[model samples]
Target: MKAAIIGGGVIGGGWAARFLLNGWDVAVFDPDPEAERKIGEVIANARRSLPALYDTALPAEGNLSFHSEMADAVQNANWIQESIPERLDLKHRILGDLSELAPETAVIGSSTSGFKPSELNEKGARAIVAHPFNPVYLLPLIELVGDAGACENAAPVLRSIGMFPLMVRKEIDAHIADRFLEAVWREALWLVKDGIATTEEIDEAIRMGFGIRWAQMGLFETYRIAGGEAGMKHFMAQFGPALKWPWTKLMDVPEFTDELVDLIAGQSDAQSGHMSIRELERLRDDNLVGMMRALKKTGSGAGGVIQRHEADLPKPEAPDLPITGDRKIPVSWTDYNGHMNETHYLEAGSLATDRFMELIGADANYIASGKSYFTIETHVRYLSELHAGNRLTIRTQVLKGEGKKLHLFHFLYGPDDTLAATVETLLLHVDLTTRASSLPDQAVAEKLGAYHQAHAALEQPEGAGRSVGQKA
Candidate 1:
């Protein structure tokens, strides 16, 4: 798949990175002489963070190209995204040209935060509002509006690239999310203008409070929980009258006076000017990845989107032995030493053991049937240091697989195929209902015997059957 990015500013560069990282050839058209460098930096940030969100590896990155001519960029593109300035005339001109130049089947998307699809298509441009949040590579929501057919076509494509496409039933200005954001923004501006809060304090008010709630559960759902036993109705009845109260200045616009600008900018500078823009971006991305990964455990909000996308990602093919675990080391796995903590080595080995169990039909279903393997012992030999962001691969070899016993050896290879670690594990087949030693099922035992027989022919691993302090 190929994507054409019409502008290479921050948002445009984000779009390009989102596509390129997802294995789509991306062609960017921007007259800015510095566009390439800027986009490259954005992609660099993306490379460091996007893959960290997944336990499985993303596809190999696709090719990226820059074009001086918009016509060249849009040629043969599967998707064309317009991200120029929010000027209607400029959008009409570019989008109209895109309609003529792009493939008829190509989905033309506008990253306009405020403009409606109808307004964008007013000048005979068949464009849809595929508005995405900032740092598009990480944030999953894309508010899609316009032609129903176009949106329906875009949703799967967006999902294929790990995005959540929300189709707006009505073409409202600013779509859905931004409208609510605009209201909050207006109230914030009033507070700042009235000297009720500083920029930092106002930001703290959001980030320390509702921001976290909203990340996992949106406004309505959060409110529904707030409703208590009676649900949304109880909460609404209690606080509904407050809606008409003069508590907020959302309807009143704060004048964009120079003094107000200085006040906000100065306060913001004082608050966070120490960090460079790139530094701030990396910080934000790290926080987002960590939070989203936490959410993945519960399949909440963005985490659920990631979990679904990960299920579709192709698993790594095994060589002679099964490649049980393949993944990037996220920052959370590192410790004060700036390398992977010792605890995670066992965690990785446990995951590999789980996968191996599945291979032998001792999987979730088998466990639910009151039979499973319980790890009784493990010995991990740390060969070398593994750091965060390193790609780790674990290959498993069955040392012994007989009734009531399963012994396995795992080879942990780092990015350079270096012998980073080795894990020797021993398990016992057990009856979950009785909580006692038991023989494996006939089918599972057959599969395990086959693997054990095949692996028995191979030479024993160097660290096999060794105690913790045993010499090499």
Candidate 2:
């Protein structure tokens, strides 16, 4: 799991943080003296944000080294991620060097946003266009297009690094992301040039509303939902007429002259002039991570991608009833109330248990099939007060899983690893379609059985449920 990142710019640094934090050894090569300082800032932001996006335990940070020589960085690495600036001959030279030094073992991935792999590999190297979005540490979509052989080999490698490789069946200039971005870019020019909207207003229009929906469900899927009960066919019948409107010229492409680039860049600056590039990027990454993780619960596109990642990832083999953490307070859980309110604390404990369940392998698609297990019964003993800033942790164990029910014991801890509360809950797998009491399928039963076999056997709790939760 060694990765060599050539040309350590913003994208290169992002790839470094992503691979390093995800338990892959990462070495970076960029002769620029400022590379260290710039990459360090990127990694610092990446460190705080990436881990917080997930409740499950992340892989340990792996080895990182910076080399002056490209060959030194490329050697012995399983994946060579290239993120140099957008210049064809420069990339060819580098790819030629990479192809010679580490030709067979590692996959050569280009961060080139626009160029096709065939054109890029004119120097006779097997390369895949692994075009990742700006913050490679977050946005999971990596537009991959290249030789079929290269893609076949690279898919599993990309997955190991927590990337979603959407294979473009044909070679096209600017690939997927940049192509869509170009459409917006063209229209945005029209808006700004015509004074129809200010640059900032246009961005706000996007970021504030429809932009949110696009993350979970992209354009076609979003349109499918807008179509109502009858779905896409109905939607098309209703709205397809609007395509002829003067509202848009879908075929228009803006000339990227100096005037246009400056216009857009000028507007962007005025829109976000208060923040530095680093600050803006950090804010962007944080927002993207939060939104994407929220979407992951539904096992939507990026969510489904994350769902699979959390499945293959390994967790520390702690005690069967291990107290992984115990803390006095965290600022996030506290509301305006001096004492912790009821719902958030339940949320916190449930989050901890959910992570535990994920560690034991209950994933989104598993829960999505309308046969999810839910907390059917619960008795919470809040022994000590919880404040806004009071840190808390929970200990959990499967007390029993008999027939269709699960008895669980949760011990909440505060400062000094002291017990704050004890919650005993019963869970049931109900048929999502029928909303009726139902036993879990054998696959789930076997997983629960494994947990039962791993832990010390115990009797069913006194209050295990024969029915669903009141809310359920």
Candidate 3:
């Protein structure tokens, strides 16, 4: 797939990085001479962040080119994105030309935050609003508004690049999320103007309080829980009267004077001047990853989207050895020493055991039938240290497989071909309902037996039969 980016500003660059990283050839055009350098910086940050969100590596990145002419950029593109300055005239002018130059089948998306589709299409330009959040490569939400058929056609393409396409039922100014954001922003600005709170304090108020809740439960759901056992109606009944109070200046706009601008900018600098923008971006990405992973376990909200996407990603087709877990060590998995934590070796082994079970017909369906493997013993030997971002591969060797017991050994190697760890584990099949040892199903037993026979000629790893003791 190929995507053309017509403006290489921050948001446009982000769109480029997203498509390029997801294996789409990208052609970018911008009048700014420094657009290539600026976009390259964004791509650098994206490379560090996006792949860190997944356990497996993303597809090999697609080709990227800086085009000198708009016509050349859109010549053979599958998708064309317009992220020029948010001026309707500028959009119409460029889009009018784009419609004439680009293929009619190509998706034309506008990253316009304020303009409605009606205004954008007023000049007979068939463009859709595909407004995405900042750091577009990381955040999944993309507000899609336009023709039904066009939006529907773009949905799968957006999903292919790990984005959530929120097709708006109706065309509205500023779309959905930004309307809410503008309200909060207006309130925050007033608070600063009235000297009720500083910029940092206002940020703290959100990040330390409702921001976390909003991430998973969103607004109505969070308040519904706050309503206690009675539900949303009760909560609305209790707090709806407060809406009339003069508590907030939501309807008021603060004067945008030079003094106000300087004051707000000064306060923001004081709040986060210690870190570079790159440093802050990394911090934000790490926090998002941590929170999203926590949500993944519970299968809720944004985390659920990530979990489902990860499932859809095709497993890396390495040669079919029992090598189940192959991935880069995430930054979150490291300790202060910048090395992978001690416990993750066993975690990787556990993942391999699950994969081995699936390969032998002891999958989710089989386990649902009241039979599953339970680890009875495990021994891990640290051969060497592994640092964060190190690519690791696990190779499994089946030692024994019988009626109810299976023994296996896993060897973990780092990028440099050094053996980093070894895990030896023993498992027993059990019936969940009866809480007793169970004979393996015939199909599973046959598969396990074949694997055991295949690995029987290999010598046992030195660490496997060793007991915990000091040599005399």
Q: Mark the regions of model 2 whose C-alpha exceeds 4 Å error after superposition.
A: 228-231, 237-245, 249-266, 323-344, 351-394, 397-472
lDDT of 2 by residue, 376-468 (tens): 667666667776334466767787766777767777777666676667777776788998879877877887777777665655443334233
lDDT of model 1, residue 46? 92
lDDT of 3 by residue, 34-140 (tens): 99999999998888677766765577789999989999999989999999999989999999999899998999999999999899989989999999998898899
Poorest stretch of ten by lDDT in candidate 3:
314-323
Q: Which residue pairs does candidate 3 place in steric collision? A: none
User: Candidate 2 vs candidate 3: which has greater TM-score?
Assistant: 3
Q: Evaluate candidate 1 by giving its C-alpha RMSD to the native, one decimal.
A: 1.6
Choose 1 or 3, whichever is better by TM-score. 1
Whole-model lDDT per candidate: 0.93, 0.77, 0.88
All-Cα superposition RMSD per candidate: 1.6, 6.1, 2.0
Query: Candidate 2, residue 11: CA error in Å?
Result: 1.2
lDDT of 1 by residue, 313-381 (tens): 877746479888888888788999999999999988998999899889999899999999999999999
In candidate 2, where is summed lDDT lowest over 10 consecutive residues?
463-472
How many clashing pairs does model 3 include?
0
Global local distance difference test of model 3: 0.88
Candidate 1: pairs in clash: none
